[model samples]
Target: MTTPDKPLIMLVGMGDLSARVLTLLLGHDATSRVVLAGRDAETARRRGNLALFTAANLGRHADIRSVGLDLRNVAATAETLARVRPDIIFMGASLQSWRVITQLPKPVFDELDEAQLGPWLPMHLTLNHLLMRAVRDSGTGARVVNAAFPDAVGPVLDKVGLAPTVGIGNVANIVPALTHGAAHLLGAPVEEVELRLVAQHYFSHYVPRFGDAGEGAYHLDVRVAGAPAAVDHHRLFAQLDNRLKRLGGIDGQLLTASSAVRVLHGMAADSGVRAHTPAPGGLPGGYPVRIRRDGAELDLPEGLTVERAVRINEDCQRADGIERIDDDATVHFTERESAVMNRLLGYDCTSVKLGDCPHWADELARKYGEFAARFDT
Candidate 1:
């Protein structure tokens, strides 16, 4: 039912996360168009058919199509963006798999702590950076929604002036879970509970591993029925994790997809809807965001300064093993992360310079391949 004048949403990456987003969008709004683009047009088509069929079964219809695209090629990617001129671009392409990496041979992965997470930042940003570059070259004013490692990746791209409009998933995923917990504790409806969080990617792992005992200064304010709720943040996070075992990893495609869809719906409607999301306007970590037709802005709750929220997230990055991303695009991994990578892959990459991402990405891919093969049995 989409007409020529309706906005076109181009979704890159036909991975599981993108598929989930596509399915949800199709069912929710049949009047908009979606183009599923990836390296494999055939595969994208297959997925598109499934999404369409799912929509049909649900008594919904959508105008959806597929296109083949390779984001790694700068010129080709730019050409596609120029040709499409989409109003919105949802980037879900990534060289690494969340499932494969997270579930690496238990022994090898166990040796590395959260502070060692920075070494993989290059792999997460490669395609995302390329797509952002393509957007710049195309001269199209399309809003971008990055679906890959936004907590760490978004800031890197932002430093280079290529950050996406907003990133999907991350801290936003925790809001609803926490809201539900508060609602249950207060005996209030979920709709009546409002939770605002100021944190980063590390909290996603921290809550799952230690729950309330998780170390970090994350800002959490919960309100029920227009009054402050007296729920303990730690206990609420623990309750959330206990309620859902799939808070982390690719199993979270459900929450991530739904979060992105909410943003898209807000964008399409041009309403300044507020939602919790990671890296809105390309700042580090996550915050409450106000999405409107003009742009997305951080909506940090009362009593929190932008500087303070940023400091909180920056400090938590160490928990993920990343020291900092320099203005020159050099990503300095925590010493522990670098050592772990050196011991595991024999690759001595202490820091990843912006232009050298492809080399490090290739090396990491090779190392990860070997790691996966060894554990295949």
Candidate 2:
């Protein structure tokens, strides 16, 4: 139950990312009441108990509970939302995990990697679409933080006025690398370094692997001790690629969970806080945002107008396999990505209509599963 003193937070998935976020929230003593909701009631209960036990051992206390929620059933989910009436909702559920692609053989994985993350949009978009509709129907004004492929998912949902308040991870995962690299370059403390970055998900992966933004368009401005500083972008990125150690697979989710905690705290604080996040106000990609009690808004760098920043991300979205999101929330895929999906899974989807997301998601999952099974041996 929510009270005036402490806010209620709802974690909508019992996956690794959500579990990590729950632990961090409890460890930070950020909230009093947290409801872990998912499809599997037993899993949710076990995860909730583990979180509670971990927090208790760490000398932290919170009201942790669990509930079974099938997001595909909008009415039921809405009923749950109306009953819980949380202050904030962090949605991490999806039809399929992004890591499913990694399960393929290395050669196959490399081939599909060229398609980028956009071809897998159906898996990430469907649940978020359902959840947002539930939120609207339930008449809850809870601020939503979507963890699904927000760089593209956020914009697609925004076409129908169902966009999340903001999104976590993605571009946010790049900020820390930039901050550390800049601090080392300037010989300054990390706390004294501030940066405003306008980017999308592509650069987050590309910069770390290739030591450059590649074809992705982005803007970065670094300030040391509150003053604009001149730093070498090439050198900074190279160091990030060469010197920084980034965990791969599930372990890397810690960076994303930390980003969500920061945004959650900012949203609850009266004075608000500034942080880098993806899909603020359902924009094309990520930007520095000012998160307040009410919501989040883009805090773009000086001289960078909203139009220019959006254009930059819009252009980069193509490199990520998304051609564009139509005004009606239909998502179009690049020719290469469409062909790749057809070749690999025999699941052809050049475009997807918002209303047909559930059908497409199911088909994609089934086809991909069969495809992966053939190579399992």
Candidate 3:
């Protein structure tokens, strides 16, 4: 429950990302109250207790609560939201984890990887759409930080005035890499370097793997000692590709969870924090943002207007396997992604209407499960 002195922070999913976020919150002693709500109450309680125990042993403690929540049931979720009246909600639920695709054989994984992250829109979109509606209906007015594929999901929800406050990870993950690389090239300390990056999910995923943006577009500005610096983008990325070594698979969630904690603290603080976030205010991609208690606003470069920044991300959508998202919330998949889904899973979804996301999500999950079963033996 919320109190006048301490704010209630709600974690809506019990997934790995949410667990990591919970642990970080406890370790940082960022919140006094936290509620872990998910589909399984027992699992949420277990995780919450373990987190509290770990934090207690480490000399940090919090009032942790857990409850079963079926986000698919909007009325129930809304009731819980109203009851808890949390100040900040971190939602990370999805029909299926993105890692599920990577579990396939290497050849099959590479084949699906060609489609990028767009073809699996339904799996990521439905729960968020439902949660937003529940948020609106509950009228809690809590700041929401979504951890799903916010690049596309955020914009689609924006069409209906249901976008979350801002998205975490994605572009944020790139900013740290760029900041460290720039500091190394400038022979400055990392703390003295400030980076403003505007990129989408595709570029974020691509640059780490291949060191370059491939065909995706982005805007990057670097400053050292509070003065603008002229660093070569090519050399910066080269350094990242050569020097930065990251753990693969679920191990990487630490970076993402850390990013989420940063955004959460920024939003909870009275003053604004200069940060990078994906899908702020339902934009096409990520941007340099100023996060405060009020909300997130674009803190773009001097020459970049919001319109131009959006256009850059809009053009790069195809790189993420999305052709476009219509004003009415209809999502058009790129030809490559559509063809790959059709051929591999026998699920022919070229476009998806926002209202039909749940059905599409179910169908896609079923087909993908059957397809993955073939390789089990």
Candidate 4:
């Protein structure tokens, strides 16, 4: 059994999936310590009901308490890390609630920089960089597993020397659910199914809901490690259909959180997994990741070529902003996405790309400037 000093896990955020994660971690390995943290106990508890329900449904018998944490007080987070001496830290605290923009008139959104993914990149990436620093400062050998917008945030965190041990949740996260259904229909063991995906956020965002990608769902191929294997596309799609059915019409934040869970569970498994997230920690788009038992580490998993990854991201980035970004140059936030961010927070702020963690402290302040002002009581 791993002792207390061996390494505990620090989970930031008390959202539904965050608690679900705590429960899953305990159910998966009860001996290990799991810290379920957040800023407000009341809100955390309120938001954590789904997690609690999911835990009970899973029949998790271990005790995982809700820990309150104020992210604004960065030092407190540092203190928690110092105390837990965690082996793995999962940062799922930040909220990725950008669905509102989708509801606005396409004409208005299409014209603004907020329409692009880059503008608000700073909003999410800033939170990640701060937390990454806390994890690094902990100095324990704990590997950190990050959730949320890793396609952009993970890489930015990496550039400043505070990269996640591994990033969880991305396009790669959605592939497995498809793989399993294909495996079952083909009568092949799930392990034998191999999938190669070249996808972008646009597909990840709209496909499951609208099935509007125009590509007839996602194109997935399965094969035994070295041999070709048959796949049942209809059955495979049935699985995707079921998932979207359940997730249909739900709040975007809730759906994103659920997506977070699928990614988390896959990353937690025994076999190694590869995913694309924002790596080099400050890049414009996502970078691929390699996940192992101890923690997630950076490496563009072997199958896909770097050139292919870059080209896909560049295409996605262009669709996001009014001006297209250069494929080779690191991309940052866009004007439309930034406008949406301003409308949401009532401020105009920009995101720092992969190399800008040092500026994150200021950026976060600017991003949160209004909300903090209005709510300061």
Candidate 5:
């Protein structure tokens, strides 16, 4: 039984991950409903960890339900939408995309029609298309959150005119992590160190992997008291940034899952406080998200840096390839992503291009699909 007045969140993936998110959401309030969705509801239900999220948390009125949904099929997705009429929709389907894109022969050079990497782009686009339709039909202003790479997906979704209300993870998660580290390096409270960062998807995704992200190459500035001061983190983060840069061959599922959990915490607490988050509605950029208590709609704060970050986020994400970060000499994206895209989508690298992508768009999508198809658990 629902609390009647409780907020309803419809989740696309009902695994331990989604269960974790639901558990976090419940911590904030008992008057909440969570509808776990997937192709195999029974499997999701039997996954004791996830099922226990609702069974133990809500007592009698704890609203947790399982439903069958094949998001790849637009109509089926729309059908799920019609039935739930939820207050919020969190799309983690792209997590599967991440898994898929990671598995290909990396930069697949040869492009074949069936083996094309770009075909998978349609998977995301179509799912979003159907979801948007469902939102429109449901007549609910349910905020939509994309739980995947924002830089690429955000822009792609924006282009298709179905950008989500916002994107989770990406640079948003990095901000806090870096901020925390900065505070320690500066020998100040965790809240004292502030990051006025202008970055793209690669900065967030590959920063830790490369172990030496941007370094002097990655542009960043730290402030101690509103204005810029010579903080030790300025140099320390640079070193750590490089150390944390994305590594070519490394397991990232755990990292990705941790980031997902952070996203859940930030979004679930939106009703209670002001916090940081990546831009919503797939704005193709970064922005300070002030989640409106009334409907959880995020907005930019008043300031030059915040505005500029938002602008930079959009520009880098929208460019033809490797967009200039606010006219600074810093590289916003790399050919690596493009090559990955091309191999993933099986598309001609030349035909597919993004401002920051190192390879073709279609190729990446196909690779993304192939990577996702093989996940056993």
Candidate 6:
């Protein structure tokens, strides 16, 4: 049912979250043609066919297929992208998920917390860097939506001129959850509640639990029925406790997927529109963005300049243990994060040069696997 004029969306991961996104896309009016690409072509094909079957069962027809995509091989990836020339690309590829990393004991987690979650930035950046290069070389104006650690990775990629169009999750996820809480508190319909959040990725992890997020600077603006509505942060955040949707290995993929779909929908729409996303065009962190058919534009709330917004998010990165992302795309980890990595995993990487990301990713994956296994038994 796909026509030549319709858009082609390429999804470059088939992990737990990616698969859920595929299913969710197929269940709705996903008019675009989707190519599910991964390192395992056969596995991707199997998942693609399953998605098609599910679509058929739901009385929907989907233009879905699969292909092999090894992001490490830039030449091959470029050749593939040049041939397909997809309109949009959604990258969900990572060696590991944050869920696995969150399974450590509280004391151990807190120790690692001092360094924060910044040590894992390389794992999230490796494949995405190469994929962006492939897009650039292919000469295709493909809008990319990164689903990795965009809170930090987006700026790193942007520094090297390989920034994705926008980042998924983070603020995108938080805004909706906050909106739902705001709507419940106001006794208004969810759609009637307009929520804007200027924050970073770190807040999503603990906000739903303790509600004390982002070093005590969680910026949020709420309005109901086109009228200003004052929100009691204490009361509003108290409702978030019941919405703790992730536990250990399990995650709230449904929320992440729904938010991502909105970004994609905005991409395919004719005119530009606004949505909350993390790291739009590789800016420091999450911001409200005006997504267009071609790309996205930063739509930061009124009175917030680009520098101030970037400064706020950049300062927030320390909570995740990333000291700074230099002009050359080099990422310097905080001393605490480096020491904890060395002591716990016998691995040491204080700074990561962007070009050296491939090697770092391979080593970090092995080390993280070993670290996670220690807790399994």
Q: What TM-score goes with each of the models?
A: 0.93, 0.96, 0.97, 0.66, 0.69, 0.92
Clashes (N, CA, C under 3 Å) per candidate: 1, 0, 0, 32, 62, 0
Residues 151-189 of candidate 4: C-alpha lDDT, one tens digit per residue: 555544554556665444445445666567667777778
Stretches of candidate 6 off by over 4 Å are 1-5, 28-30, 103-114, 214-216, 243-249, 271-273
User: TM-score-based ranking, best first?
Assistant: 3, 2, 1, 6, 5, 4
lDDT of each: 0.80, 0.88, 0.88, 0.53, 0.52, 0.80
TM-score, model 1 to reference:
0.93
The root-mean-square deviation over C-alpha atoms between each candidate and the true structure, in angstroms, is 2.2, 1.4, 1.4, 6.6, 7.0, 2.4
Better of 5 and 6 by TM-score: 6
Write candidate 3's Cα lDDT for 4-33 as tens digits: 445688998999999999998876544647
Candidate 1 lDDT tens digits, 33-79: 88889999999999989888888898987778888899989899889
Clashes in candidate 4: how many? 32
Reference-based lDDT, residue 235, model 3: 83
What candidate 2 gets wrong by more than 4 Å, as runs, is none
Please give the distance, in angstroms, between residue 364's alpha carbon in candidate 2 and its true position after superposition: 1.4
Candidate 6 residues 184-220, lDDT tens each?
A: 8889999999876778776666577566574634467
Candidate 6 TM-score, true structure as reference? 0.92
When 4 and 5 are scored with TM-score, the better candidate is 5
In lDDT terms, how accurate is model 2?
0.88
Candidate 2 lDDT, 277-327, residue by residue in tens: 889889988999888766677888789999999999998888888999999
Name the better of 2 and 4 by lDDT: 2
Error of 6 at 84 (Å): 1.4
